[model samples]
Target: MPYRKYSELAELVEMMSMAVTSGRFMNKLDDGTYYNLQDSYETFPVKKFENAKKSYAQGIEEDEELLFLFDITLFGSATDGMIITNKKIYFKDFLEDPECIDYVEIDKIIDRKISDEECEMTLCHKGKATKIKIPRFQFFDHHFIQFIAGYAEILQQNNHLLAQGKAVLKDGVDNITDIIFDAFWNGKKVEKIR
Candidate 1:
């Protein structure tokens, strides 16, 4: 799916009922794609992972697009995962209450590379900083850090478009590539698909 819309968070969580055969958990992005897996993977019976979706989706805004979500704990407790929208980052720390940090309020983000598999990000805002350890997909492959650096601008653009009642379309993440003479190569510039 290039982009997914769920009226309720439960709808989104239900689709993620599939058991990962190769990866630990599902990670998704807004560019109309998901990393580490695809749509065809087999699913567990709906009853298997149903109720926990409620706890997970509690903090999500009704109209905000869920740009990314990742499971971060062994138990699907109150503090089990993190979500990133264009406006803010929502996450939970172990045994802590669900929290939200708006991008517009952030002053800085210090990303510490823990390893190739994961990282620790300290979100500094309102004279306080909260550190959250997250997966490494956002570093090289997903451009998450790049997005954070520009989210203030992104939020401004979104608000401007909203004020004008205009729609917005975002680009997805993929290796920039080209086919020249029937051979594949990384392209220097990103060109429109059409």
Candidate 2:
């Protein structure tokens, strides 16, 4: 839901950077990487809805928590290309189940091959088009954390740069009263106790 609202990928990056610097719910690891507290809370075994139906048919209670975990992982991978490889997750069970299958769809697109044109043109003239290959980006658990922490550290180191800019909106002119609020009022309800 949060990812859906972002207009561009760069905006999401900026928000993530802000979140890391704001210290809302991120933790710094020993290796100078930052770990999102939300990730740990949301982690669970991946399962498919059809597999859950089969489990129900087999007299096993449907595990909604497991399904939620699977969705989280899938969404995380799609948004960041980061695969969280933790042994505790029951990914094998999801794969082995006949009713459920992990989603893996790769789309191939054809682009103009400038290399052939370049070779032909270069044989006649000195000008030639260069072929460039772009590398794919991957974000693993360690790297993701490191990325967050690196940004956070950079923000801390460059506090003066941020302070130099004038604030468009001013803070409250007068003191504000404290207000009590339910912690989980605006948060997702935890389904399982374990």
Q: Which candidate ranks first by TM-score, i.e. highest?
A: 1
Model 1 ranges off by over 4 Å: 1-57, 75-79, 138-142, 156-194
Alpha-carbon local distance difference test for all models = 0.43, 0.24
**Candidate 2 local Cα displacement, residue 12, angstroms:** 9.7
TM-score each candidate. 0.50, 0.17
Give candidate 1's whole-model lDDT. Answer: 0.43
TM-score of 1: 0.50
Per-residue C-alpha lDDT of model 2 across residues 68-154, encoded as one tens digit per residue = 112222332211111211111122122333121111110111232222111110011123222211111122222223332332322
Cα-based lDDT at residue 156, candidate 1 = 42
- Cα lDDT of model 1 by residue, 19-97, tens digit: 2212333443222112221223534223212222354445556645444455555543323556665446776655766
Each candidate's number of clashing pairs is: 2, 0
